[model samples]
Target chain A: MMNYGIIPISHLQLAMSIILVLMAGLVSAFLKLGLLKSLIWGTIRAFIQLSLIGYLLAYIFQINHFILILLIMLLMCYIAAREATRRVNVPTQEPLLVSFLSLTASSLLVSVIVVTLIITPRPWYSAQIWIPIFGMILGNSMNGISLALDRMYNEVRSHTAEIEALLCFGASPWEAVKNSVRKALRAGMTPTINSLMVVGLVTLPGMMTGQILAGADPREAVRYQFVVMVMITASAALGCLLLIGISYRKMFTEDLALTEDMRQSHN
Target chain B: MEVFFQFTQITHQFAPNGPFIHASGSLQPGKALAVQGPSGAGKSTLLRILARLIKPTSGTVIYQDQNWQAIPPRYWRRKIHYLPQKPVMFEGTVRDNLKLPFELDLLGKEGSLDLDKAKLLLTEVGLPLASLDHDARTLSGGEAARVALVRSLLIDPEILLLDEPTAFLDTETGKKVLMYLANWLQNKKNRGLLLVSHKENNLAFFPGMQAVVIQSEGTRG
Candidate 1:
């Protein structure tokens, strides 16, 4: 029973999810929240949501529905955007909108392109393959955009004069921000890069390890990780590009000077 | 050819709920305008307004015969630079910071000084030519202030706004910085300075440079 694959993975995930919700409830209790209510409410929500998602995924795998796969892809992006919005510093909220747009457009484009053109999954829009793969891609892209937005905003704020001075002198807004932009992009992508480097050597990634334990051949597991990692990297890159380009306007004026709202929000 | 900047009835209040910190004042260009006041006075605010770093609550800043409102701010910003009470040290080398004022797009299009002129300006301020090759973060306070001043002037802006540039310097260093500025203003015959300082001796350093004691407005004590 311990060695069994899907059962162990599901049990572990359930336990971990329960523990996290419990911890959140406990923390909320100390903060004078309705602790018992949240604990019960949160556990139920997670169980239902995950159970429904699990059945839905099974249905998707059997049906191989393209429309359903696209919908799921979009849903993942929407959730990712929501998560990212909770973390950024733009007070007026255009930055949040840009983040959402970037996450949706970039992750979708990259996932579709890579999955279709490169991986060439049989049936092309196969839901079983697309949903899980898109999930990883969109999730990481969300993290990337969130981190990049936070960094770019902070950098622009603290170095306001310098950035303006650069713009005044002749640097295009993009050129003026090339340093910060590159740094933001690098910051957003670094974690994924580091995790990819250590994945098989340090610890098997959840998906690959799950598949291997579920009796898939080691070679097959490696192939899937290879495809997933490439997809994730592509998604992260596209996400950063979209975020920087689209959100660049919010940080600067039409003249491309850094704005006061961006500068003073932290204070 | 004419005045570099003109401030007309410019006022700024830092706190929306607080009393007006800066009453309106009209200042002409090509003349030294000294902003002297108590700590809470808006000397810094006024200077920032001239630099267009901070917009005034009311009134206008005219530069090069056109009102500041009409000009593209980035275009005006190219010609305007403010030295804060504490100038920020941008990351990287000393050469990096000194080279900054030149990096403005305006300088690139209209024209900018070569390295030799920059070195001369640095030397006049008593900063070593070797400073141009080192990191900015390592510099002492007085040294950084001197560097900030030199860099601001390097852009050749018609109007200059300085806030407590000499605060961190000793008597000798402060005088040297002031004297260099006075000489530069005289040499250029047009570029004016709005300096905010408390040092009485510093006032004497630029005789031809006009002075205004803001606290002199009221408060007999």
Candidate 2:
């Protein structure tokens, strides 16, 4: 058995981390960037949020029950869905439902595959493995879904005349908005695809860094990181595809015309 | 007189508290129904409803002895094409734009593009034959309008719901478009026109054309 000793951080060491934020604050103040308040607020919020999640996760791991794990995942998904829907500026019908369905479907599917097929932690539904993996998948998928929804709506709104023209030419709603949907799906998936291209060379992704810092073998961490990268890419692609598939119909009326609301430009 | 297309008691309100606009009219085959009204009196809305592009609050449209609802919207729209005031050009050549309708699953091979007919129409509309390959997005307003009209004609609609078709063209070109439409209505069987125009003189080109005036009947009581 390989023994990699985990370095423990003291409360004093954690307290001293404030010095890094203070350095950023000094730079902001010198430049009159007006971001000092946001910096301070962000630091405080991050501290509280991370601390609360840490204690909650510790408790969850200790309980190690399947139902409790499921409930926590659901709660996380609901919050993520709300956040995703809030990011879209275009008016949509039942966006919360769409976002929730997309995130839950894609994130849950990816997480299940990762845990069951790839990682295969003992007892399969082990809370320690499930919760964090699921959380990461949900976070990335939520961002992808939000971006896709926003892009689709804005694209539809801007292309109302073209779409209506297609409808006049006997295009089904799907056919009419197909170009916009392509553009939107491209917009949604581009970031993840681009990150895939430059993953190791450009930036060290968060999960791999965390695992390495926590004293996992570098080779083992690399393997986990590769799984996570592919998992995230799959979740984002699936989430965007699902979101656009279900939500494209909202841009049209039952009569197969571009919705009146979509016709009016969003000022 | 045989009525080819008839819509009765068509009503719509743009907003919840807005005034109600009432419209009723019948179009005869081989003739045109000129939808005339003040700028904001829902003339375009009337044509839109007939085109099935917008649903009227309450109304019934009958076409060729069939209720408008009986036909699917895609078929209805294909048969009763609505050309808007501002022409929309897709990201392609005029030839591609002309061939667009046939690319739709609704048309399949039944409505394949007739390139010879397209070139003829382009010439009749005063565009050079070579203009067919010109980028659609680069066409001037008048050119785009004519291309849009030709595209609609190629689809072989029974009735055209033209909203300000001449709005972008100069008077001579507008008259040419009107003349072309006049010839179109005469040359084809089962063809009709529902034209919305701000310029009454534009209506003059379609001789013996009947008129339907839409009016707002004050706020809802």
Question: Candidates' DockQ values?
Answer: 0.29, 0.82
Best by lDDT: 2
Tens-digit lDDT track of model 2 for B1-221? 88989999999877777787899999888999888877677787787788787778998999999999999999899999999888999889999999999999998658589999998898888889888889999999999999999999888888999999989999888888899999999997899999988888988888789999887866433
Off by over 4 Å in 2: A1-4, A25-41, A90-92, B217-221
Give the alpha carbon lDDT tens digit for every residue of A99-137 in model 1: 778988877787788778877878888886677777888
lDDT of each: 0.73, 0.88
Please provide TM-scores, in order, for all candidate models, with all chains considered together.
0.83, 0.95
Clashing residue pairs in candidate 2, if any?
none
Give, for candidate 2 chain B, the lowest lDDT window spanning 10 residues: B212-221
Cα deviation in Å at residue B15, candidate 1? Answer: 5.2
Among all candidates shown, the one with the greatest TM-score: 2
Give lDDT tens digits, candidate 1, residues B42-151: 67767766666555668777676787778876666666656677766677777787666556555656665577888898888888998987788889988888877777
